[model samples]
Target: MNKTFKIYAVIFIIIMVILALFEVNKKEVTDWRKNFDVNQKSPFGLFVFNKEAKDLFKNNLTKIDVAPYDYYTDKNKKPHNILILESEIDPESWNKILDEVSKGSDAMIIANRLPKNISDTIGFYGSKISYENENVLKLTDKKYQNDFIKLDKFPSGRGFSYIKPNVQILGKTVEENNEDQANFIKAPFGKGKIYVHCEPLFLTNYYLLQSGNVKYAQSVFSYLSDRETLWFVESNTKESSSLLRFILSNPALKYAWWVFLGGLVLFIFFNVKRKQRIVPIIEPLKNTSADFVKSIGNLYLQEGDFHDMMAKKAQYFLNKVRLDLLIDTQNLDEEFAKRLQLKTGKSAEMVNEAIVLIKKAQDPYASVMKEDLARINSLLDEILK
Candidate 1:
C-alpha cells in the first residue's frame, strides 16, 4: 500500500507540474516585479519581453546575453543599441556601459535602482512615496512633444527629482500627486547619449497584456536604433557566489540539497562520535605484607640467596627479643641463651640448639636445610608466645 501511494503521489506531482507549465492567467492582476526572469509573469518580468522584444527588430537584429565589459572588448564600436538592466549593476559594469554608450551608441537602462556612480553621473533625486495605488506613465517625449503616451496597470512609480538644464526629463508617472517627479530621463554624457527609466514595470507581463501597452513598449524602444544588438542584462548579474541562486536555477535539485544538509546535521547531532560507557578504573589490588614476603622468598629461592634470607629472619627475631623481653641481644652468648630459655620456658638444651642453628644459618656459605629452618621457627615461636 505504501509503495502504491508513493507511485500515485509521483503521478499526481507530474500532472500538476505539466498543468502549471501550460497554465496561463488571463484575468489575473496585481502580480508585479522589477525582475527580468522569463518564468515569472510579474509586472517587470521578461515573459512578455522574451515573446515580443525580438519582434521589435526584424533586420540585422542580434540579441546577446553578455556583460558590458565582454561586449566592449569584443565589438570594435558600440552600435545604436538598447540595454535593459533589471537590477543594481556594479561600478565596473556601469563604467563599461558608459564607455560603450559614449562611443556613439544609445542605451535605455530600465531599472528601479542604479549604482551610486551612475546616479551621481546623472542627477537623480527622490521624494517620499506618498502613493500606494497603481500608477500609469505619462510620456513627455522630445520627439512627440505635443502627443501624450499614457498607459495603466504599471507598478506605482517612485517620486524623484533630477538636475535639469543639461538633463532632459522625458517622462513623468502620474500618481496621487498632480504631477509626478521625472521617472524617465534622457541625458548626454561624454561622446554619446543615455536614456534611463526608473519605472521598469511597464515592460512586464502585467501591463503588456493591457490594451495598447505592448505598443507603448514598442514606442519606448523607438528611441534606440533597430539595427543593433539588444543585451538583456539579467538580475543579480554581478559576481555573487549565491547558493540560493543555484538552488533556484535547479527546482528539482533544491529539495535534494535541503534533505542532504538536514540529514548531515542530524547525523552529527544524534550520532555523537562514539558512545562507550565510562569504563571504571579497576585498580589492581594493593600489595599486602604477606604477598610482599612471599615474593621476596620466591626471589631468594630463585637466586640461591637462602643465607641472606635466614640472616634477615634471625636479625628480626633478635630485635623482637630486645624490644619485647627487654633482654640484651647484643651477643648470642650462654647468658643470652639462658635468658631466652627462661623467657620462652623451653628447655636450656633446646634454646642452645636453636642458637647454634641460627648462627650456622647466618654464615654466607652455610647450606640451608628445611628441617633446620623449621627448628629455628619453633624456637622463635616459643619466644614470641
Candidate 2:
C-alpha cells in the first residue's frame, strides 16, 4: 500500500478500536452490583422507593438520615413501621425498638443475624452465609402455592438463616439437595409483629431495577402490613452536604485549595525566619578580688616577716571580737577569757586557748611556726562559731 493509504487505514483502525472499548467499558464504569445503602441515590440505594415513599406515611414521609431511635420520639402518636437494615442492634436501641413495637408499632428488621432477645423470642437461629448462583431462595406461604419468589443468578452476601419452630417462615433458600433454608420469619409480640427478612440487599435499587425483581421487592413490602408510617433505617452515618466540601471533592477545586494552602505555608515559612529576634552575645564577668588578695598573701609568704603578719591577724581577731561580742578587749588576761566565754557561748577551755594564742600572736618579735599559725586559725574558728 502507498504511505498515505497505510496512514489512513491505521487511523480508521484506531477509531474502531476506541469505539469498541467505549462500548465494553461503559457497563463496568456504571456497574451497580455491590453498592448498598438507604440514603444514597446510587444503584444500591432506595431511590426507586422515593416515588412510593411519601405515600406510605400519613403525615408525608420526610426521609430520615439519622438512626430510627434518634429520629423517632416517644410521644409520637403515629403508628410507624420501621425498616431496619443492619447486621446487629445494640442493647439500648434494640430495647427501644422492642418497646416501641410492643406499643402498637411495627418494625421490619432485615438482617442475617438478629439480637439475642429477638432471636430467643422468635425461636430461630440465623447465620451469615454465601451461596453459588445455582442455589436459589424459594418462597412459600399457605396463601400461595406457587414458587414465584425464586431468587437466584445474583450475588448473595450476608443473608442466610436456619429454621426453627413457633415463628412463621415466609421464605427459604432451596439448596442443591432440595432442602429448604428458612431465611424469612414473622413473630408476634404484644400488639404488633416483627417481620424479618434475611435478604435485605434484594430491596436495593440494583435488584429492583432488574427484570421481574421489582415485583419481588414489592411482594416483600406486602409483609409490612400496610402501616401508617414508614421508616428506613441503616448503619450509614449522615453528613450534611456543604458547598465547601462539594468544592473540595472536585479535582479542580481541591487543586486550587492545595495551591492556596501551599502559598500560606510558604508565607508562614518566610515570616517565621524573618521575624526571629537577633540574640546578642554577652561575655561573663571575671572575679579579680580573690586573685589580688592571693597575690598579696603570696608576697607576704615570700618574705620572712611572720611576726608582723601574726600581729595583724591578732588585731583583726580583736576587732572581730569587739564587733560580734560587744565586749571590751582592753585586757588579754584569764578574766578576758572568762568574759568572752559568757559573751560568745564558747566553752571555757576553748576561750582560754584562743586568748593565749591571741596574746602570743600579739608579740612582734615572736617567731610563728606553721603549727602555731594553724592553732590560731582553729581558735578563731571556734570563737566565730
Candidate 3:
C-alpha cells in the first residue's frame, strides 16, 4: 500500500511539472503569433482591414488596378469600374481615367491633385483650406446635405471638417490642405458614382479607434453597399516591396552556409600555421658552490665573525683543490704531504702547516679567536694570492 501511494504521488508531481512547462511554452507561442492582422474586421462595424479594402466593393463593382500615372496612356487597357490611388497622380492618370469615363466606364480617383483638363468632373476642388472655421460652403440642396454630416475635427489634425456625404463621395475630397481637417466628397461619373476622401486615416487601424471615424468608415462602405464596391487601399512602398523580396529569397541559408565555410577555413589556418608556446628550459645554477660560499662569507662579515667565516670558506676551497690535485686524504699524513709538495712545490713542513690550519678551522672544537672582518679578509687575501 505504501509503495503504491508513493508511486502515485511521484506521478502526480511529474504531471504538474510538465503542465507548468507546457503553459510557459504556450504563452511564448501566443506572443510570437500576435502580429498585425490585415484581414481582421471590426465587430459590428464596416471598417475592414486595409489590405482588404479593394475587395469590399468586389461583389457590387469591378476593380481596375491602375498602374502609376506614367504607365497609363490612351492605349492602355481600361476596366469598366476604375479607381485610381497613386503616390503622385499625374495628368496622364487623369487623362486616361477621364477618357475611360467619357467612354461610359465608371471611375473614381483618390488623389491630392486635380488635373486642369478634368475640372468639370470634379464637384468641389480646393488647393488648401481650413475645415474647422464655419467658412465651409453648406450645400443647400436637401438631397446632398442629407447625405453628409459635418465633423467637428478632421483626422489630419487640422481644424477643417469632414463631409460625410453618402457613398457617392467615396473617393472625393471634402477638405484640402488643412492639416487638421479631412474631406469627403462624391460626384457622378457617367452612370457610376465616385467618392473621395482627403484623409487616409479613416481606413487605418489607428484612426479607426477614433470616436466618429468608425461611423464615417462604415458610411463610406454603406455608400457602396448597394453596388459591388471595390475598395482599393494601397500601403505598399517601393522599399517595402524590395525588402519583402529579399526576405523571401532564403538569404539566411545562402549567407549562413558561406559564413560557415569561411569560418572553417580561418579555423584550419590558425590551428595549423600558428606557433605553439615553447616550454622554458631552466638550466641549474652553474656556480652554485661558489655562490653558497660567498653568501655564507658575507653573512659572517655582516655579523662581525669574519675569522670563522673565512676559515670555513678556506676549508671548502682546500677540499676542492685536494680533489683536483688527486691527493689521497685516507693517508692524510703522508699522501697529503706528498701531493701538496708536488702541486704547490712547497716544503712538507709549510704544506703540513697549511693543512693543519684547514683541518683545525673545520673542527667545531678548535678555538680560532674572533677578529675584525677587515683583518680576516687581509689574511685570506695574502694566503690565496
Off by over 4 Å in 2: 1-35, 50-52, 55-80, 87-89, 142-154, 157-161, 175-178, 232-237, 247-385
Cα error of candidate 2 at position 194, Å: 0.7
lDDT of 3 by residue, 7-50 (tens): 64576567556655665565422121212234333331223444
TM-score of each: 0.56, 0.52, 0.35
Which residue pairs in candidate 2 collide?
Answer: none
Clashes of 3: 29
The predicted structure with the larger lDDT, 1 or 3, is 1
Error of 2 at 61 (Å): 4.7
Q: List lDDT for all candidates, in order.
A: 0.68, 0.65, 0.48
Pairwise lDDT winner, candidates 1 and 2? 1
357 Cα displacement, candidate 3 (Å): 93
- Residue range 1-385, candidate 2, lDDT tens digits: 5565566457656755665566556553444654455555666566565555564343444455555556555556556676676534566667777777888777777665676667776566656566555555556675533434444536453444544555787776665644566677787777877888776666666656667665555556666756554454445535449988877855556655665576567556655765668889898877789899899878878995666666677788899888988878999877788888888888888888878778888866667886777788778877887
Ordered by lDDT, highest first, the candidates read: 1, 2, 3
TM-score of 1: 0.56
Best model per TM-score: 1
